[model samples]
Target: MPHILLVEDDAALAALIVDYLRAKGYQLSHLSRGDEVLPWLRQQRADLLLLDLMLPGLDGFSVCRLVRGISNLPVLMLTARNQHLDQIDGLESGADDYVVKPVEPRVLLARIQALLRRAQPAPLAELTRGQLHLQRSCRRATLGGQPLELTHSEFELLWLLAEHAGQAVSRDTMLQYLRGIEFDGLDRSADVVVSRLRRKLGDHPKSPEKIKTVWCQGYMLLPEVSA
Candidate 1:
């Protein structure tokens, strides 16, 4: 059963949501104040979060941002305001999706299911391709038996490629994965980051087998022979 942390101030609404979700076989813990959310989250293992925009003590945006800094847990923002700016703000604040209040219980449940499915971790325990070895739980990667010093972005990029070894990942998809902000102007930036990562990984741009660039598509990480 998927566990969820629900942060909403409205007691009546929260109760209704909790009851509806419990009927769907989901386990949930509730918090009425945003200030309590982070502390509760630290002590609990939740599969997804249901966050309300308005709350006492830190607002939902701050809570969402803080949570994203530590974990990649999926968040669904529920708000009474139905403005485009509100939705944009929620997404920018690290919410996986946004839903306005007065929403159907069934609709919210469907969105929750979708987010849970997407947030599921890859099945592979250890990923190796060429000189790279990635331990998922430890979030550590080594190249040629030496630890590779990588930034957070670099590590995530390598992990995504290594996880899907030999399969081409489109540039658009990679950009979406790396930075939540997606704009056409940022395409060059993504390419630059990938180039720097390739150099750091000691991959040859001329005949790169580790991260192979597919013309007009994206890149692929060729699998290495395990010893």
Candidate 2:
């Protein structure tokens, strides 16, 4: 069962959400105050977080930022403030998504399920190619024994490539795997994402060795599975 940390101030609403989510087979931990969130999260492991914007002390945005700084755990902000700026602020603060107050229990559940699906970790068997080593469960990658700093998207892309190591992954295929949709008019965005990923992985686009660009095709992880 997926564990969720729910931070809400209203006792009645919190109870309702907890009951609904628990019925849906989610293991839930509730905290009414934002001040308690960090400590709770540090002590208990949760797959995702459902946070309310208005809380006693700290506020949800700050909590989201603090969590992002330490871990890439998925966050879904629940707010009564429907302003676009509030939503943007939540996202900028590292929330995966946001929901307005007076939310339908069903919709919240759907969003929670979607975020969990997107945040699923890669399989946890060792994957190595040359000096690159990826440990899926921990979401850690090292190149030549040096730790690699990767964003969530970059990690996912690397994991996908490693899964099919040595095979060419077309841009469309990668987009589908990453975004769950065809690039369509977002081809440039896909290229930009890949370019950023290459930079993070220390793979030069020109004369690349680890992740090779195949002209108009896509990318391939070099087949030398060592290190």
Candidate 3:
């Protein structure tokens, strides 16, 4: 069963969602204030988070940003506001998905299931390809037994690429996986970040043997080069 931590200020709506989701076999824990979420998360783990936009102390956006810094757990934003800007803001703030208010219970459930599916990866404590190794627990990565100094974002991007070694993961998918948000069609930040990672990995863009860019697609770790 997938466990969900839901942060919503509305009592009635939270109860309805909890009951509905429980019936569908999902285990859920509820927090009525945004400020309470991080503390609760410290004591517990959840497969996903159902976050509402309007909250007492910290708003949903702030909560999402903070959570993204510490965890890769999927987040789905729930909001009564129907503005496109709100949706964009939520996504950029690290929400995996956003749903407007008055959503059908069935629709919400389906979305949740989809998010969970996307978030699921092979359960591996550590991932390795060739001379590269990544420790998921510590978020530390090394190449040829030498630590590759990487920022949090770089580590995540490399980890995802390493996890799906030899597969050309799309740019949009990369952004979503590493950033916990959707790609704005025009955003080339993923490319830029990949370039930086490549430099650190000593994979020249011209004749890369470690991480390779699949023309117009995304990136992949060279499976044959795995030492």
Candidate 4:
């Protein structure tokens, strides 16, 4: 199910919309304050955001700006303000669409469905090595058939290693690919990331198996299967 994050403070309106959307088959997560949006998104992924114009902690415009800094998730603003200026401001603040409040449930549903259809992600970019699988498009990874929670940096490192499976990928190459910078030899960025990856992948730090160190070149990801 497509997961949506809803940021609305109205108890009655939020409850009514939540029940309706859930019954329509979309997964919904609701929050009351605009300030909570960024933290929630940092820890979890959502397909879309439903924002309210006038929120307690922060207004929808500021919240939308913050979210746009980190993600391109589609945002639909809802509010009692029907002024065209408000709609234009919301759109300029990074919202995909704006709807005035007290809207018919059927129309709201149609707008939501249309937005989701338009925001569908592109083709998946994936790589597999035995029990390890990485979906770069979604930034999701799995190891030993279990989902692995990885940070943005960790996922990028893992994707680079998997892309060049069975061969040593130079630290310089990885650094450039990930951060758009050359490895400084003094930089421990790759080392720190590799350590974190090892722990998450259950590889022994002292005697690692999945990701192994090269004497001088860099690191290598042992191919789990010959296919």
Name the best candidate (by lDDT): 4
Pull out the clashing pairs in model 1: none
Let me know the TM-score candidate 1 reaches against the reference structure: 0.55
Writing each residue's lDDT as its tens digit, candidate 1 over 4-121 gives: 9999999999999999999999998999999998888788799999999889998999999999989999999997755778788989999999888886998999999999989887
Computed on alpha carbons, the lDDT of every model, listed in order, comes to: 0.84, 0.85, 0.88, 0.89
For model 1, give the 10-residue run with minimal summed lDDT.
181-190
Model 1 local distance difference test score = 0.84
lDDT of 4 at 84: 83
TM-scores, one per candidate: 0.55, 0.55, 0.54, 0.55
Model 3, residue pairs in steric clash = 130-226, 130-227
lDDT of 3: 0.88
lDDT tens per residue, model 2, 138-221: 889988798888877788888888877888888788788878989675466556766876776676677767777777777888
> Candidate 4 has which clashing residue pairs, if any?
none
**107 in model 3: Cα distance from truth in Å?**
0.9
| Tens digit of per-residue lDDT, candidate 4, span 1-227 | 98989899999999998999999999999999988999999999999899998899999999999999999899999967558888888999999997788867898888899899999866449988988988887888887778899999999998888878889999899889888999887988988999999999988889998899988989988778221
Go through the candidates in order and give the clash count of each: 0, 1, 2, 0
* Candidate 1 RMSD to the real structure: 14.7
Q: In model 3, which runs have C-alpha deviations exceeding 4 angstroms?
A: 123-227
